[model samples]
Target chain A: MGLQNAINGIPLEWYLIVAAALFSIGLYGVLARKNAVAMLMGVELMLNSVNLNLLAFWRYLAPESAAGLAFAAFVFVVAAAETAVGLALIIAVYRSLKSVDPETLTQLKL
Target chain B: MTLQQVIFIILAIAVIGSALFVVTTSNLFRGALMLIVAFFGVAGFYVLLDNGLFAVAQVMIYIGAISILIIFSVMLTRGMQAMIPRNAQAGSVAIAAALLFLILLLAFGPFRLVVDLSGVPILSALFRTESARVLGGVPWQFANREVPETYIADFGRALVDLNQFLLPFLLVAFLVDAVLAGAIYIARQRKPAEVIAEREAIAKEEAEELAALQPQPTAPTLPQGAIASTADH
Candidate 1:
């Protein structure tokens, strides 16, 4: 209940709430932004929020286990790699159309 | 609230507010900038969770690398005048929002969170004692024997042993190289010479049309009173 007691300092549910808010915001960004690059940024934000939740749970529930740390590291690396490829694809799209608007990119239509 | 909890609340507010701003801003550049701030806030959360390494990595990667790359791509592809369109599927957005709200309720609404505040004091005590011993240059006692300072060396050597992360590290290198090659190939193929030629032809046609629209005078037209003035002279 006090600052001196680490056990009851901050509730785990608060972290969960923050994580949920972050995820929802990310979803809204993904839905609203038409630029492919912006969409990719939203996806990254979503992934980061998920990772935060995982790390928070790991630290609170099982601090002794190194698995959580390892998993978070893996997620970070994967996120970086995914963004690289995604941004490259976005660049390719821009080069072709001179614009990055998703609505105008309709060449795949039959 | 306790100081720790108070700090956490402030950080959570910063994180959530910046994330929302990043999502809702119409300017793509501003959104990217807000994303960097959001990343820093998240890293602060990481530090509060006692993960200093992760905090550093988050700042270095998300703030430094990923955000910069996104901003660069936005600038390269479109000028500042480009407007980001709003959501196209209102129905789908409403449905997704409903689902997200339900999930949040299910995940956090019913659970009571318990925090172990006493653990922090105990950890602080143990860390202080250990640090005092380390600073005093006293050898660590292990199995009733005084162990030398070479313990850290042994730990480091064991970490790099054949059964450890060597293979995964090398594999990551390979993956990065492959991604680089693929990106180069894709970039090269996106812009063909034919597209450039077509754009140039269109530009030339527009220029020619504008040139033809101008009045072509076979002889200079006299002013309204110029002929009368010459007759008077």
Candidate 2:
């Protein structure tokens, strides 16, 4: 079969390329998307792309060290906590202003 | 041109498309949904890279919790369906674009192809004995095995091992607890009167909508002689 080579089925650089592209796309979202909640979603995407880069390096190059894998695991916990607090704050803002637009809340009125 | 490469290409496209949709869409609800799809694609990438542990974690934490929380916020806020054109700050968009272009130039630059590939054993069978060095990383001496077999076990051991990662492990737990308490305290800081007032306002709004839905019942005229003769007749 021409499929399923045990090692090097794909190059490490390809993974990096894709990960970098994904990260850039996420950056576009973060800076461009107007809604605050969507902006947070963009942040999650960027964080995830970073984790992908870490894990790709670990799996392909440094299989012996657990450092990269451990770092990715830590990122998971941080992302979860961040989302919780971010969403809670968004809800609080919505309750006060009755809107979630990022432009309207320019001042620290709330 | 192997089957694995083919699969990787497809996944990369799916992931990029969904991620682009997540940011580009004006409908906030649709953006959240696209985010879920993008997260699933990332989990699939983890599976491709043989990190089943991270794949499960990705799905459980990102799709299970974060995406749902975002959708809930979108639903709770008004104007979820009404598409609003983003008031894109031109300066910020320009900055984000320039930053992305620089990163792409650095990453996909011409110099990357000239780098030596002698160290990685899995990909380079001809140079099995030599150590392979990638950018900014320690030279990896060829390990005895190819793909790691004990990933799940290794993760558990590394997580609990006192000398290695125990401190950060405990710190993460503490930080999560702090976030929980802080989120609750911060979100509930509204005064009691304000809370009651918001509740009443929401209730009144819903009641008005309900009233608008029902037709006013016309007054039924009493029977001229027999006050509405009988229930049976």
Candidate 3:
């Protein structure tokens, strides 16, 4: 028994609830924010919640098999790549129009 | 009432509070800063879940890299924090999210009634079984869900094993490389005018430094001479 052992472990439901709430917040950002960068930020938050769900399930349901853990790590890799590409595209657009607002980017032009 | 629960609650607050600010805050830089805070909470989650490696990686990647990349984009485009935000759609966004939350909350149900739902019998059986298998593959025997040791080793084995997790692992590697190349190219497509301006600034600085190293009398003439030499007329 260690320091973490003293407290009864939280039920898996609590973690899931938190994950759900975070995900909803992210969804709102993606929907409401006109800035492309802000929308991307929302996507990042959603991905974070997904990772939380993954790790929670891994810790609560099957810490034996490494499947859940592997999936979570894979998610991080995918997120990093996605963020890199997203930011680059945003920069390219900003260079052209001097703005990152999504509404103004309705049509592509030279 | 226990310490674990207390810590979990605190971490949850940090994560949720900062995440809310990340979207709601008008200042892009401030939003990015809040995002960093939210990512910190996620790192804390990894620690609580007993994966020290992932906790470190989360901090390193999310905070050290992704957040910085986002902020750099904000700064490069112009200080996005200074611009007035378009928040007209916020109300509708909130309403949509609230609707989604209610739907999921009910679906999750109390007392983990998800298993009782008839729509997802396969899901129920997977969670209820001793060892989960897809299409009844070789069954993994039930084991402790909290064994903190051997996690990194097991993760490595799972990733490389040809029979199980190899495909996704390989795909992840390939995708990362492809994205890295594409992002670098797209972000580095510097416009010709900006490139010329940058070159001019560099040349001006170099000329100044060269003039400073020489005698005062010679220095004045050198700048004028260089300017005159470079002039098209």
TM-score for chain B considered on its own, for each of the candidates? 0.56, 0.64, 0.67
User: Pick by TM-score: which candidate is best?
Assistant: 3
Interface RMSD of each: 7.2, 3.3, 3.5
Q: What is the C-alpha RMSD of each candidate to the true structure, in Å?
A: 15.5, 14.7, 13.8
Q: lDDT tens digits, residues B114-161, model 3?
A: 323224666746553532322223222333446568889988998999
- In the range A8-84, model 1's lDDT, one tens digit per residue, is 36655567778877887788778877777778878888888888987776666655544566567667877887788
- lDDT of each residue in B53-147, candidate 1, tens digit only: 78898999998888998888878776523664465773476468558855674546434222333346664465554353222133212122222
Error of 3 at A94 (Å): 0.3
How many clashes in each candidate?
12, 2, 0
TM-score of each: 0.69, 0.75, 0.76
Q: State which docking tier applies to candidate 1.
A: acceptable
lDDT of 1 at B179: 79
CA lDDT, candidate 3, residue B72:
89
Model 2 lDDT per residue over B112-206, tens place: 42234664556556543333433322333333245568877887899899988999999999999999998897678778998899889989998
DockQ of 2: 0.40
Residue pairs clashing, model 3: none
Q: Rank the candidates by lDDT, best first.
A: 3, 2, 1
DockQ (C-alpha based) per candidate is 0.30, 0.40, 0.40
Off by over 4 Å in 2: A1-8, B80-85, B90-95, B98-102, B108-145, B189-192, B196-233
